[model samples]
Target: MLNSNMLRKLDMQDLMVFVAVYEQSSVTEVSEALCVSQSTVSYCLKKLRTSFENELFVNTRSGMLPTSKATAMYPHILSILKIINTCHSGIPAFDPTQKEITFNVCAPEYFELLILPKLVKRFIGSRFPVIINITKFHRDIPADELMEGRFDLVICFGPNFHRGVKGLRSQVLLEDELVCVVDKNFTLAEEAFSLETFVACQHVFPTPWTSDTNMIDGWLARQGYNRQIVARANSYVAALNMIAGTDFILTLPRRIQALTCDENTFSHRRPPAGLPNFTLDMMWSEKPSQDSANSWFREQIIKVCAEDGLL
Candidate 1:
């Protein structure tokens, strides 16, 4: 059963309302988020339900839960809105100083700890009214998510992470090597930092992502050596806390140690020779290459990294 008349009455505002309501799960919240009155949101929802001839949402004790039809339609509607927004953004030029813009970025905790502060400072100094939303990187394909408008940019450890993903433009932002962080009082049997001492020490590993194995473990495996990792932490901060007054050593990026560690509380030692260096990369979908706003944003990131001597 099709309702051509009702469908013809639907508009982009109605679609926006549907998405807002679905995400917020409250009509009042949707109204506040969309800067519309409650009556307007209700009218839009009513129109959408009529157009689709479905009870898209049902009132529940918990909240306004989406019906099966709404669940199925959510992604499609979101994609449509993204496409429309892209079309509308195809301007000749972008001026960050004059426009209010929001950039959604996906990155690991490393970026948050080392780069985000300086990046925000750059924006503030330049007087750009920009909003940044950061999300955790889950080792997903940046190209697919960027194409779907999930994120405007992605910051990852190495360029190889996106090797097989097509239509992605990436740039190396910075390079860092592994370093061992331990309590200042920690000492080695010998003066020189040796692999034997490193492996002998009880280590605290930082697991920022879901992967059980990391570059450190892989490198150790290749050399037929494994460290005695006694604890696994979800973040570098947590790992640092775990090794604060203990004998546990944490092996992490050198920049992280430089930025986060206190000279009095913790000291950094060079990891065993030949540990591989890693590069941080910024990636975005190639489809938006012509988007001046995105282009400008990328330039800003690179500029900030360079100014900080990280590029």
Candidate 2:
């Protein structure tokens, strides 16, 4: 029964109130959910009723029951609200194959070895025409850089995020336990490396270029157990090289060492007790949450990780 002029006068807020009231059947409940005043909810209901020329609902003992007219028109209004939501969320006709986009991501060498291959394959097979630029993880880079749009996203381990940063979000992409990597020829490779031996052996530590110590070193310091660090390397590969055919052993994430190390030259075992497991997390700015292309990209990453049992 709505006129063309009345329909033109309606807004999304009005439809929202109508839907809320229809579903909740109470003006007070609608106000509480929408964070509006009861009068505002009542006013919207009055306006909607006037436009439709029907008393949309009738208060009954059971609830605020919808009248026949409101009941008949409910499904149509629901569909319209859904369409409005889709439009507000992002572009209506987003096509990844036809549209070109470039996303910037910062990650460490381990991510490049394990995650990038699957992500790249997905985009290429779909002909997404998208570009992903990945850079090394740097401690000097502030974690809030993602929120500032310096990069679309970042993947790193145990990100030391600054407190009080707003509009930042993160999700853990993969979890892996710590493992000890040593040359196959190392004497301990033939038998279990005990906690005492772990503390006594010469260690090839992989410290970040910006820091003097790594996670294992920090944990060891807390427990008053210090391993002998005979050498320090910036990356896992460098640390592995320092261990090959030597008595030195490198402790790092199991998944990365598994993918990068040659089984013939290297042997890996669960690290001695007290070593902690780590998770790789993807952090990003909240601004991209509403972007269709960015949402699609995030979904693809999550899907790939889930399918591959990375999460």
> Using TM-score as the measure, which candidate wins?
2
Q: List the pairs of residues colliding in candidate 2.
A: none
Can you give the TM-score per candidate against the true fold? 0.67, 0.69
Candidate 2 deviant stretches above 4 angstroms: 1-84, 87-94, 159-164, 189-192, 207-209
- Model 1 misplaced regions, further than 4 Å: 1-91, 159-163, 189-192
- Prediction 1 TM-score vs. true: 0.67
lDDT by residue for model 1 (118-190), tens: 8888889889899989988775656667987778998887846444577777888998888888888885543
State the lDDT at 230 in candidate 1.
93
Residue-level lDDT tens digits of model 2 in 80-164 = 9888777788455457877688988888777777878998998898788889898777764445667677788877776452233
